[model samples]
Target: MELQLALDLVNISEAKEVVAEVAEFIDIVEIGTPVVINEGLHAVKAIKEAFPHLRVLADLKIMDAGGYEVMKASEAGADIITVLGVSDDSTIKGAVAEALKQGKQVMVDMINVKDIEGRAREIDAFGVDYICVHSGYDHQAEGKNSFEELAAIKRVVKNAKTAVAGGIKLETLPEVIQANPDLVIVGGGITGQSDKKAAAAQMQQWVKQA
Candidate 1:
């Protein structure tokens, strides 16, 4: 499993500092939706330019106009762009097509999709790069997680690599790793810790060992 560091609620500079602290431990740096809203695609560009080696994912969580949005994010140097799975199939198709043309990738976020397995099965046919089971902040506040949903999708999704996100932390990481997801996404798990590098390093070590 690969480790993805999610940067949410941070500006361009803070995001840089955080990533620089744990750069060696992370496989991907995520420019989260809030960061995108505050800084625009410039956040993606700045991060990608700063760290050309690490892959950068722009969390657009796009719901429509997938092709145009993907094109814009790809232009800003995003290696992977996200789209909401609840979006129409055509939207996913458009995003996938645009990403392929841009030589980038699309990760479908199943944030609130009611039928995880069913929709994942269908989206797998669209040939997206990743299918992520996610629980939004609100869902997390309600003490919810996507572990079960992750398991649900793993059983059916064949074409896309699987990812799991939503409140994942160092303590709970072993449980996540046991599921053997292709990617493990952590936000506050590392960012909120007293020692970000240690947390990221430990998580990366565990993932690599797993």
Candidate 2:
């Protein structure tokens, strides 16, 4: 499993400073929704330029103009781009194909998705590289994630690679990985801490054990 440290709702300089230390430990560095919305794609460029060795993902939560959004993110140097799983087949296909053409990977976010099994099948069939099992900030605070659901999603989409986001602390990493997600995205767990390198190292060790 790989660890992805999430920098969400944080200022760019602060996020970058944190990333400078943690980048060596984590497999991927994620620019989360609020961070992207607030800092724009500039954050993606800054992080890419700052940490050339680390992988960067831009969480655009793209819902429209799939091709354009992917292109914009790619121009900003995002190694991976994300689009909504709830989008129509054309949108999903468009985004995936564009990312492929640009040599960038696409991750489909399954947030607020109803009929998740059916949606998983659709996204997997559409050739999404990953299907993220997400609990948005509010849902996580409400205690929404269950290991049963995590395991079930992995089972439901046998073809698509899986990832989990929201409220992923070091304590929860092992249990979450029992479902076998390829990656773990954590926001507050690492970025919110005073010692980011230590936080990232802890999560990295936890993922290795998982």
Candidate 3:
């Protein structure tokens, strides 16, 4: 289980707290789209600058002018920049190209993508690091861990690495890993708790046992 700690509220202090707590445990620290859209690229820079050791994933969720967004996030020290899966093929192509030139990583986020299989196949040729299966905040409030969609996403992408997020918890984590996601994300499950570090540590143990 490659843990991704999500920073959604966009507070640098909150982000720093989570990082300080999970720095030794989590693999990737994500600057969520909500946070980025609210706070701009500094959210990514602040998190990256604060925790330089951990890998930073900027959830820019770019939908247009892909190259500019990717380049901007990359310059902000984001190791990985994400673009919306619903974006036009040309936009995705442009983002991927910029990422390559910037020596950065690209992740295509499948948030509300109409045709998961068709979209996945469309961008399979792009040099992407992860095919992120995401659930926005509104959908998460409704109920979570749509294992069915996750399974379908995994089935479609045979080559690109997989990632899944959306209100995940300890018990549901096993079912998520069963889908063979390269990364399993948990935001409130950890950060929402009183002890973020202990929350991370507990998850660390769970993944090791898993």
**Model 2: CA > 4 A from native:** none
Which candidate number has the best lDDT? 1
**What would the per-residue lDDT of candidate 1 be over residues 76-97, giving only the tens digit for each residue?**
9999999999999999999999
* lDDT for residue 103 in candidate 1, whole number 0-100: 98
lDDT of 1 at 88: 96
Tell how far residue 113 is off in model 1, in angstroms.
0.5
Tens-digit lDDT track of model 3 for 140-208: 887754566678777878777888888887667777766777787888888887887888887777765
Candidate 1 to native Cα RMSD, angstroms: 0.4
Cα displacement (Å) at residue 112, model 2:
0.6
Report the alpha-carbon TM-score of model 3 versus the true structure. Answer: 0.93
Q: Please report, in order, the local distance difference test score of every candidate based on alpha carbons.
A: 0.97, 0.84, 0.83
Judged by whole-model lDDT over C-alpha atoms, candidate 2 comes out at 0.84
lDDT of 2 at 62: 92
Please report the TM-score between candidate 2 and the true structure. Answer: 0.95
Query: Order the candidates by TM-score, highest first — what do you get?
Result: 1, 2, 3
**Candidates' RMSD to native:** 0.4, 1.3, 1.6
